[model samples]
Target chain A: MPRWFYQLASPRWCYQITGKLLPGFAIAALLLIAVGTVWGLAFAPPDYQQGNSFRIIYLHVPTAYMAQSIYMTMAIAGAVGLIWKMKMADMVLKCCAPIGAWLAVLALATGAIWGKPTWGSWWVWDARLTSMLILLFLYLGVIALNSAIESESTAAQATAVLVLVGLVNIPIIKYSVDWWNTLHQPATFKVTEKPAMPVEMWMPLLLMVIGFYAFFAVALMLRLRNEILRRERRAGWVRELLQQQRG
Target chain B: MNNKATNACHLPELKSGEISFQPGRIFWATLVRELNLALRRRSDLINPLVFFLMVATLFPLGVSPEPSVLSTLAPGVVWVAALLATLLSLDSLFRSDFDDGSLEQMLLSPQPLFVVVLGKVLAHWLLTGLPLTLMAPLLAVMLFLPAEGMWGLMLSLLLGTPTLSLIGAIGAALTVGLRKGGVLLSLLVLPLYIPVLIFGTAAVEAAVTGLPLGGFLALLGALLAAGLALSPLAIAAGLRISVSG
Candidate 1:
């Protein structure tokens, strides 16, 4: 392994690196999201069918994207922790669940808000929406399992196994849900599958998605720093760092 | 210490000393042991079935009891009840073994944990899932499910419940070390159960409407195949973490 990768296993190195990277990600996330939101809401042309109600797409798409990506991130990090026995990877996995769950909730809420105008209901049981809801539950399950176990390492390992299992099942669940939805509802006009969006609309969406990724980085790093500190509080470097911060 | 030494000497020499990789034997031994234990504790075997029956009963009482209403809801109601009953029974899957230190021994044994986990899950399916499948028809009748859908209900449950047991075992193993694993187990397992429930109910519903059953049944079979292939690895990993951690 490369030096930097190996160093990541060291809590002190991880904390230092995240501390350095956090501000840039935070600033990028803020600027991009703010600019993207304004551009998407005001500058982008309204959907011919839905009008201004389509603006919720700015929030919904990014968060929905983030929710799924964060889950993938969590599961991949968990696999890394399980395979490499990397403590920092475990911390990353542990910190990811809440953020992912919240993003899923945000996606669902925004989807609901958007749904009222587009689908004429707060909830449509659309396949994508239902799968997103299930994804939220999956995140919650990881969180629940993590907190339920008394030992942190054990909890990490257990949740890693679970996240991996969830990873495998996600595609199956999504497909089954899609099949089930189609069988019952039969093509309810998928909102996101519109004919190629005008650049003005899609460009902002792209920005928002990137912004969400940056924002997720910021959130994950912040949580990861705290997790590293908490789990490594007994180590000499942590004590030194604590004293250094105090002084 | 002296008594321990004497007891060790009382065993047959080959039985005491031999440590060979006999996965088939380990699988059967674990399955038989689990079956034996489950049979001895008759309540553990019966409780989930009773729960299944009662939960199915709730649908008719809670919803409209009219035959038309229940017959329409029967497939979903029966599948949901079976799913819950399997989940209800899952907590005890590894609980007693973990408590009794046999789980630890199983982990330490020369045989692969995969075989042991598969065996245990098979035994669990036999005791809980199979019985649930057999009892489902009676519940379906009470719920007024159509005669045509009966084959679909039983076949779907037969195909799906084993997958349920396998997947639920992962949760059960992960939570085996925890005291209040019952609720948490459901929380962890139920989301994963969604696919099985979808396919299971879809099969029955298709049968009810006289749609082609092959697709749904085939999908259910695919899920069971995947579950059989993948779940034991997860179950073994979970068991090790629970036991060691």
Candidate 2:
């Protein structure tokens, strides 16, 4: 294994690395998100179709994308942990669940909030929205299963299997839903098939997506550092770190 | 992970620690064992079907009883009820074996765990999925589903329910080790269930509208084929996880 990859296997090493990286990510996330929100909300030209309501996509699209991306990350992390017996990978898997779930919620809430103004209904079984709801359920299931299991290793492995299974279904769910939508013709608007968009509208959306990814990194590192501290509290390095902190 | 590196240092010997048995015979034996178990406990066979019936019954009472209304909703109501019923039966898929310690034995078997897992899943589908497929038409009738749609309902369930059984076995394998696994099982399985439900209901709706129903059924069939090939491996992986822990 390469030096960096090998180093990542150590919880203490991981904790230290994340500690160093967290601040950089945190600052970047804050600046970018603030810029993106202000730019998208205030400056971007309103859609010719939906007018002002379309601005919510800056929040909705990125969070929705992150919601799916984070779950995929958890699955990959889990496979690495299960296959390589990498302890830190399990930490990644466990720490990301609640963050991913809430991202799904934020995406759903923002989508619904946006929907009321755009679609004249708070919720519609639009394919994308319905799939997001199911994603939330999948995240909650992993969380619920983890909490239900008594042994930490057992929980990790079980949730790993589940995350993997859910990963496989994501594509199937997406395709089936697209097919169903075409069959049912339930569209209030076909926003999915957007033609060429002006760069001004898309630029802030790009910033928000990047910002969300950075924020996810910061959030994951924070939770994982806490997990490492609690799980490895009995280790000599943790004790040494605490003493160093006290000094 | 390498099986050798599972840190599974404790290799409990099976009653008959033989791996030389033919795969077909081993599969047959496992299937027969599960069948016998399901037969002995009649409720395992009946309860889910009963639940399917009752849930389907509630929609009519809960919603409008107009035949036109019921007919339009029949495809969805019946499919959802069938989906939930299969989920109800999935909780016990690996529980009995785990509790009796046979799951550990199966894991350590010279026979590939995938084959044994597939046999058990096959038995599961036969006991639950097959019966539900048969029972669906009755529910369709009760829901006032158009006669034209009856064949679609039956065929879709026939093809689709086994996919549910296969996909759900992964959830069952993962959760079989937990104490309160019932609700969690549904939570884990239902998202995966969406595609199957969508196509199954779509097939029936297509039939109701006199559209070409073959396309939706073909999709459902494709799903079943994929489920059969891949899901046992996932179920095997899940069983290994629970067993290792």
Candidate 3:
């Protein structure tokens, strides 16, 4: 095992290391997301059924995917923090909440926008939408709990417990439409199903997913770095780093 | 002389530990103490009940008072209103104890903290949650909920409201120390409440249509079980943070 992985558990090490990685990840994320957006929006074949409006999938699907993924990441980070008492894990959990919530909001907005043309209504209590809305509320609850408390450590601990308890709803949200007969269409992106589109369509989608992941990585690194600096501002090393930046 | 002193000290230590660790006595005593405190505050007991009645009354003003229409809307309105009333009651759950130093005393007690927390949650359920459950029939009558669905509605509330109290405890515990915590408490607990709302409302709806109540009741029971087992642990943890912070 690399000593640096454990060493990065220290906020100072995370501050320095992620600083070096940030620009590289930011550039890569921007390049890939741009290429993916263009390729998916302009070049990909329109759906035979939904037509050009299907292009919103490029933005909607990736964010929806990220929304769920980020919650899982938050939960895991919370679990690690609780079990190991790792400060870095708590930082990761804290950083993930707002990003995850924003991603959920984006997914909901884009989904609603896409729904207007396709489903004839802007909103419905369909399982998929309802579940996603619930996910948004869960994110909000975590953020609310974190902010309600005066002490950071206590807020983190309280939020961690809420995250763990709320995790039961995640599987329910993911499967509710599947288990019950519902107006919402079933899962479209199943790996086992034969491809419904030419490579031209799915290739860009694949790219978009990868791009979104990279974008999240870049954003997380930046936020994590800032969190480290703010948290460690009283430390001599932070003062030195700030002075160096100023110089 | 030294032997007498040692025996006397050891005897007191052993007796104290044994008495405090008696789970049954500790649980009931904590529960009783919380109930006593809640009752001693007349406003706390009366406020949630009044809120429940007022919310139930608003439906008639907002919607048509035609019996059929009111009956159709009754279960949902009553349940939603009860949920809100529970949220109102939750605002005071930890705030008073936290302010008056009772919470610190509870924490420093020899009893296990989880049991004490559980007792507080149970007392909260009795004061806020149970009253709502018991009052459902009266509200249902006012709202024109069908007579047939009455038992199932009551049953659902009986089973489901405790889950609400338990889940709400975590939010209450978290926000206990915040200024103007009422709105924040609702925001924190309402989303976590979706499952209970779904199942609880569904149970009453199912009964109105003469659908089997078995499945819906089972779901409510399962939720109660899950909440009962897990929420105290979360509340206990939250209380520690809120108190210590």
Point to the candidate with the largest lDDT.
1
Writing each residue's lDDT as its tens digit, candidate 2 over B1-245 gives 12222223333334664547557766777787777677777876999999999999899789988998999999999999999999999998988788877788788868777788888999999998898989988998998999999999999999999999999999999888778888888888998998899899999999988899999999999999988888888899888888777
lDDT of each: 0.87, 0.86, 0.84
* Top-down DockQ ranking: 1, 2, 3
- The best-first sequence of candidates by lDDT reads 1, 2, 3
Instruction: Report i-RMS for every model.
Output: 0.7, 1.2, 1.3
Every model's TM-score: 0.94, 0.92, 0.92
List model 1 lDDT by residue over A75-184, tens digit each: 89999999999998889999999999999999899988988867778987656777888899999999999999988889999999999999975675446445545422
Top-DockQ structure, candidate number: 1
Worst 10 residues of 1 chain B by lDDT: B1-10
Clashes of each: 0, 0, 0
Return the clash pairs for model 3, or none: none
Which of candidates 1 and 3 is the stronger one according to TM-score? Answer: 1
User: In model 3, what is the error at residue B67, expressed in angstroms?
Assistant: 2.2
Q: Which is the winner by lDDT between candidate 1 and candidate 2?
A: 1
Mind giving the per-residue lDDT tens digits that candidate 3 earns over A31-96? Answer: 888999999999898999999998998999899999999999999989878777778988999999
Where model 2 places Cα greater than 4 Å from the true spot, the runs are: A173-195, B1-18
CAPRI tier of model 2: medium
